[model samples]
Target: MRRVADHLDIPELERRFRTCPDAVEARHVQVIWLLAQGHTVGATSEVTAFGTRWIEQLLERYNASGPDALANGRRRNGLKPSLLTAEVLEVVRLRLADPPPDGGLWSSRKVADVIAAHLGLERVLPQRGWEALKALGWSLQRPRPRNPKSATAEEAQAFKKLADAVAEEAAAHPGVAVEVFCTDEHRLGLKPVLRSVWAPKGQRPTALGHHRFLWLYVTAFVGPATGETVWYLTDTVSKPLFADLLDAFAKAIGAGPDKRVVLLLDNAGWHTLPNLVVPAGLRLVYLPPYSPELQPAETLWTLVDEPIVNTFVPNLDRLINTITERCTNLTTRQPEISSRTNFAWWPANRVPS
Candidate 1:
């Protein structure tokens, strides 16, 4: 017989056993891995720091009932299973499984309400309600804006043509001869995010005792070929600040667009205004009206907003520094942005046949 250590395969064993809900639940799988390593149950238990009795019980149970039983038990003993057991989970599944009351898709709140009502819960306290649903893997999320102002067919085509032009031109240039920067601005509040909690059906939910609103603006640039990003953070996004941000972005890609620098930017008033000033090395191309998807930088901002800037920073200085540090770290980790080439400019009437 192969010795336990000789055949154990620790990495593979870890992968299999770690899938269990927790260390306690995974003990059986741990024993299996150890036993396969050629150790007796007592020895396996000793090495695993698990009790021999428990390991033996698991082994015996596995032999009698098989692998599935070892993972998910068929029964819970004694008390009757509450209707609320799968509780909000059933609510989500049923709602999604069928159409809503208005014969439309089920809304988040309605799903919450149905689950609470079905469990015969009078209050379905918001705190415990969200927790329960989350435990069952139900998350309340909102849809994002899509199909931006490409408000008109002509405008959408115009933006598409611009993006394709830049892409094609970069193909014509070789080895860092050109770079593309898809740029955009994101604004965030410095207040702690409001979290939904449970309360009695008719009772008002609790509110934060002290909360203040602050603002942050971020400018992000993305490289299209590789998904790399560079971001700048500021408190106020003024015209001059915008110009400064543009200069910084130009240096970021090693400037001198004589090599051709294409900037995929939005049609925000600042970008289009004839009065606004910017650096000479960079050239701007507009995204289709109402269209934000073409700008890869938006995806970068989503990551920043969701993970890095999700909560309030203490003060302006700390927030600014923190934002810069985080942006640098993210940019380092995602190095593909350096390769992004600018959009090639073409006349509005041009369309690829």
Candidate 2:
């Protein structure tokens, strides 16, 4: 039998146990009250549904700190000071800007080491390190891959130049309706596109892969402002084929004397203006070399791959059919497309003057 100190009278303990609003606190108070009334620890455990060991611990707490200790301890804060103070968090943020001391990716354990060193402590728990990261408003994320050959300054200058050219063209032809669009080509083949998916613990999801060389080209033209999309499927790509596609796109959009369409493109060999034919009312603007990040149409490939990813297709016809269905479905989801492709700095659609 554990002894409870003379903290409160039996009547006061009964009043507290009855008046406690929280169920957990009330249960804890009832345990103390039962023990204070000369009940054995085993008797209190049977009555309160608390374990014998836990009841003994509760008696120790009440004896040490009285009624204040009888309340749910979890609800009480500031009992133990945290080492991750505002100053320590600021130091962590600055350290994160550079590669970690071990020259690898940052993890909870690595962050724990950083925190421990900053406070001059021997060590900190990885769980506490993760909590500190959440407190600092940080999350784990995979970084987008950047091309080594991409010129940042040139990409910025090209964007500004494109914006100015659109403004200038709109001013030059006051009566002409000007619309901006991005165009790109994606190649889908018989090769399986693998992706990660959730499964039961200790069991990995499997995807069937059949590698073949047969290919299909999907050329996409998208209006970032409205998310209106035009898709063309072909067996292959050539300068003549690209010219025919442009003409078809122009006719489909009714881009003629009254409407001018400025098409943004990458510097592919066949896309250059040397011998290739370009239709009237359709002007081509090239993005900076090696800068696919600036091309809004590049983002569409992920959405295009959704139907075929991790699924095996028997032949080129099946792959084409699956992708065609996916494309048709994507056309109806304009808002989703716009949210993915519309960059903050993209030029807005200009109404005719």
Candidate 3:
């Protein structure tokens, strides 16, 4: 190949001709060019080495299709129509809307079987409901589980009462500037996800084992009224770390007793422990147990940690730095929640089973 380039002394021209020529005429032109350059058929075949018959047929095809045939041929393996038609789609829709005979969330395989039975399709054919939903532009997702140790009705009523009292207390005593803050920690693994590779048809791309340790801790503060957030990323979530964060916020608020910060955070043992000793201007208020939805900081974990941090971080330090940067950016960019609600939203509400 190297000698061929030097022999022809037209590397640029060869590249242009090969790339620009109509597919039909390209092979024929190349063969003629090689022959004219003082090369025998066998030698030219060795140099440009395309089949002689194929070269001739291409020349003929060029004469027939003009420049249009230069476009690549339509691939037979491209996406085809589903064997399951509109009728089958209707069956799937109906099955999904209604629960199975044995109540509870339908598993993917069970949903597939239900679809198969309704449309008389093979299980394998309906199993592809997984893909069909994507084709239909519906996100396939599972419901969150209800907490086993969830607050009882009486507990809920008590919380609601406390909430009202807290609101009224702050209202009557405007001197107490109350703010709810939720705090939590997150971890990151250090392994580069090899984005993606295009392979020859029917071949899977290779991958390396992911083994790396990257750790980080984030103390996030979210405003309940607006989903606005503030966060600090550090090497660990120790008492000193929490104390430092609290002290910073307390000093930032200054000498006004009216600027008292009431933190509505999780019941994480560290956050709740009395020995942790919250700063003077700041108070530690706990969110109802098992109620993550009420904590606006939970959004950060769902949105930031799972996708960007988990997938992209490759080394421990890089992971921590990425998280810190992202948290800082998000703190500035997050939109306020605007409306505040009394109770947390959950898909699985307490219902008689």
Candidate 4:
């Protein structure tokens, strides 16, 4: 048993342990506090969940420097010299701009090989390669899938045009409360939607699934600027149904000569203007073909599916009820919705006339 010096009395040590703001410092204080109470080093290790060797080192520091030494020392020590030099990092950055030699995605091993080749070494550790990537502020990310038919230049031009059109509408009806909204439909069914979740190292979590073709459609109208959403649940989607939804939505938002609305949506078959009954003061703007990514309402589907993902629904009614509840809750979370859907290029609310 190593004696804890009388630098801090037991009650003072207890107070420091309790009031310490830093978690690591609090833990170190706890070890010293326990030892001051006559607990052996092995006993203090068991209590703090710290190794005995670590407790011994901590005791040495505390006895020598008093309570001030309990703070985490690792943070004060600056980072060690990186293996990735400036020249090497530039080479890695340039190489990353193109596909790897194998015409596949770049990996740590490939980056290590690149580094090794540059340094004229036989090989470099993959761990060092990973560190190099971090030093360059690169992260592993799943790429967003894009439709090959979608034209980037066309999307940019279309967005600019839409912004202009919205501005024009606001200008035409000045001070009439013109609101920009994006609407989309999502299909949910009895089929399970599986997603990865954290579990213990060797244990895998399971979700019960019963795949069925029975479906329900959730139509959402979301304002990108304010995140105000109007949701309608229906069993089917058609021109007539969509028209009715438009009428209901118009009534809900009080869209008319007093308040104009510019609604953006995709070029779906049911969303066409022909034979479609668009309500008064509601102008429909179609997004460029094959560009669902441009639709703000498209971002709401993930939020709408949270309740039912990786879980089994016995029937359509249960699924509908679950989704309905989720949608109702989402209506209150405007800030979250706005943050997710408000793309930088999307026009701001209340555009100057």
Best by TM-score: 2
Model 2 spans > 4 angstroms off: 1-3, 7-30, 39-53, 64-71, 76-81, 153-158, 196-205, 321-344
Model 1, span 28-75: residue lDDT tens: 677877676667877886777878787777666655665554563433
TM-score of candidate 4 on Cα atoms, chains taken together: 0.70
The superposed Cα distance between candidate 1 and the true structure at residue 195, in angstroms, equals: 8.5
| Model 2 lowest lDDT segment of ten | 73-82
Show where candidate 3 strays beyond 4 Å.
1-141, 152-158, 168-172, 191-209, 226-228, 253-256, 306-312, 336-353
The candidates, ranked best first by TM-score, are 2, 4, 3, 1
TM-score of each: 0.47, 0.81, 0.49, 0.70
lDDT of 2 by residue, 132-243 (tens): 7888899989887777777586555556756876787788778888888889999999999988877899998888997999999999999988899999999999999999
Question: How many residue pairs clash in each candidate at the backbone level?
Answer: 24, 0, 7, 0
lDDT of candidate 3 over 172-285, digit per residue (tens): 556455554445665545554444546799987665546665556676665554555666677667676677777776665451355545566677666667678677656566
Whole-model lDDT, candidate 3? 0.56
Report residue 182 deviation for candidate 2 (angstroms).
Answer: 1.7
Clashing pairs in 2: none
lDDT of 2 at 322: 87
Candidate number achieving the greatest lDDT relative to the actual structure: 4
> lDDT-based ranking, best first?
4, 2, 1, 3
What is residue 129's positional error in candidate 2, in angstroms?
1.6
Candidate 1, residue 103: lDDT: 81
